[model samples]
Target: MAEFLQFAFSGLTVGAVYALVALGFTLIYNASDVVNFAQGDFVMIGGMSTVFLYATGVPLPLAAIIAILTAVIVGLLLHRLAIEPARGASPVTLIIITIGASMFIRGVAQIVFDKQFHQLPAFSGDRPIEILGATLLPQSLWVLGGGLAVFVALWLFLERTLIGKAVLATAANRLGARLVGINTAVILAIAFGVSASIGALAGVLATPITLTRFDLGTIMTLKGFAAAMLGGMGSPLGAVVGGLLLGLIEAFGAGYISSVYKDGFSFIAILVVLFVMPRGLFGGRSVERV
Candidate 1:
């Protein structure tokens, strides 16, 4: 039982990070219908920026804020320079553009941050709490708490705020939203910026436990995409559930099977979801009129 609890805790910690990344994907996809493969780069930017900035004498909290802001700026730039300019293009083209953007961001990160893996000091020190013969890191609490907080905040924003309603309207029907005098361009920009901020925040929170490197975003992107798809691509609730499920699968697989194939388990989950339940756990069925 203790061993199971230990794996569960580990799964939840990593799952929280994946959920954040999946949320970024879901937000942008809903607002703009673009997948934003470069989403993970925001994670890289947040962690690397904070690391370098803190190293240069900036306070850790302030540095993290600045890093998140930097990611938001980059996200805005991505929309303005790439996605916006390619408006009305094919979905495939937009996807390819995002892929290119991801590559560009990764290249730039390599130049700016070098090729070394970096770690941040744990926010609450390195203390472990024991529960039912299992151990939990203080940082794991931060990760889980952060994930829950963000989910609630995002829910409130989307369901209660006027701007959030406008975003929802835009996602529902871009043409109708424009006809109703909504500035969809601004809405899309906000989506990207918010998505980037979420991704960055995840990076800041997870870096201490996971460590980070410039190239880490690529794998993160894949994992996040899988989680997003597994939960139903456009459903926020689905993203969280899918991410947690994927993480648990990975943890149990690694603990019981072989760590060597841990990464393989996520991909396998992806395949299973694709073949068995393409719309995911929370995804609604789509209909079209001829």
Candidate 2:
């Protein structure tokens, strides 16, 4: 039972990070049909920038804020420079462009941040709190809370605000949105910014536990993509469910099976889901009537 509790706690922590990453995917995919493969780079930027800034004598909270802002700026630049120029391109082409952007960002990070792994001090402290026969890190609570906060804030923004409705309208039908006076370009930019901000927040909260490195983005992106697919690509609720499920599977697999094959568990789950529910657990099949 203790072992189970331990794995569950660990799974929740990792799952929360995956949930944030999946949310980022949903936001960008909804705003624009193109999947931004560079989404993980936003996490890298947040973690690496925070580490660098904190090392430079900046306070932890302030450094985290600056790190998130850096990601937002980079996200804007990516939209304005790479994606905007290639507007109206084929979806495949846009996807390739995002992959290129990811590679480019990774290369720049290597030069600027080096190859060493970095981590931040926990928001509270390193003391381990006892749970029901399991120990928990204060930092883990921060990550979990941050994920919940992001979800609530996003729900409020998307459901209660006019600008948010404009974003959803743009996603539902870009031509119709534009016809109705919604500036789709602005919506796209805002989506990227929001996505980046969420990814950065995940990084900030997770780095204390997972650490950070320039090359970490690729794995993060893959996991997030899998989670999004598992939940239903365009559904926010689906992303959350998928991410937590994946995380729990991984944790249990590692605890019971070979740790070396832990990642294999995720892929196996994905394959099973694909075979059983191709549209995803939360995704509905689309139909059109003439």
Candidate 3:
């Protein structure tokens, strides 16, 4: 039971990060058909920037704000410089572009941050709280709470706000949205910015627990993408469900099986699920509009 609790806690921590990254995927996918592969780098930026700023004697809250904002700006620039020029390109081209962007971001991070791992103090302090006989750190609570908050905030923004509706409209039918005076190009940029911001926020919250390093975003990004797929592509609710479920799976797997095989098991499960339900459990079948 103790070991199971440990796995659950670790998995949820990792999964919270994945969920945030997956939300980034959903945001970009909704506004533009292209998936931003550099989404993980945004997480690195958040973590690295915060560590540096905090080290420079800046207040933690202010440093976190700046780090997240910088990531948002980077995201916007990625869309403007790379994605916009290649409009109407094939999925392979877009994928390559994003992959290139991810590589570029990591290269920059290594140069700027010196490839060192850094960690920050948790927002709530370094105390462990017990949950169902499991000892969980305050930092874990931040990660989990931050994820839920982002999810709720996203729901409200999308369902209740005109800007959100415009984003959804653009995602649903770019041509129709443009015809109706919804500047989909701008929406795409906004989506990238939003996605980056979310990723950055996740990084900031999780850094205390996971530590921060220059090349940290890749695994988190991959896990998050898997979570998004597990829940359903282009589905925000799917991302959340998928992230939480993946976390629980990893937790139980690590406890029951070998910790060394935890990551391997996730991919194996993804393969099995893909074979059974290609469209995802919650995602509907795709249909192109004429």
Which pairs clash (backbone N, Cα, C closer than 3 Å) in model 1?
none
- Give lDDT tens digits, candidate 2, residues 1-290: 88999999999899999999999998888888778899888989999999999999999999999999999999999999999899889878989999999999999999999999999999999999998889999999999899889888887888899988888888788889999999999999999999999999999999999999998889889999899999988788888888888999999999989789888999899889989999789887567675
lDDT of 3 by residue, 1-290 (tens): 77678887888887888889999998888777777789889999999999999999999999999999999999999999999999888868987899999999999999888778899998988879887787999899899999999999988988899999999898787789999999888998899999999999999998998888999878877888899888887888888888887888887787788778888888888788878988666787677777
Q: Global lDDT of each model?
A: 0.91, 0.91, 0.88
Distance from true position, residue 269, model 2, in Å? 0.5
Give, for candidate 2, the lowest lDDT window spanning 10 residues. 281-290
Off by over 4 Å in 3: 285-290
Choose 2 or 3, whichever is better by TM-score: 2
lDDT: worst 10-residue window of model 3? 279-288
Looking at model 3, residue 107 earns an lDDT score of 94
State TM-scores per candidate. Answer: 0.97, 0.97, 0.95
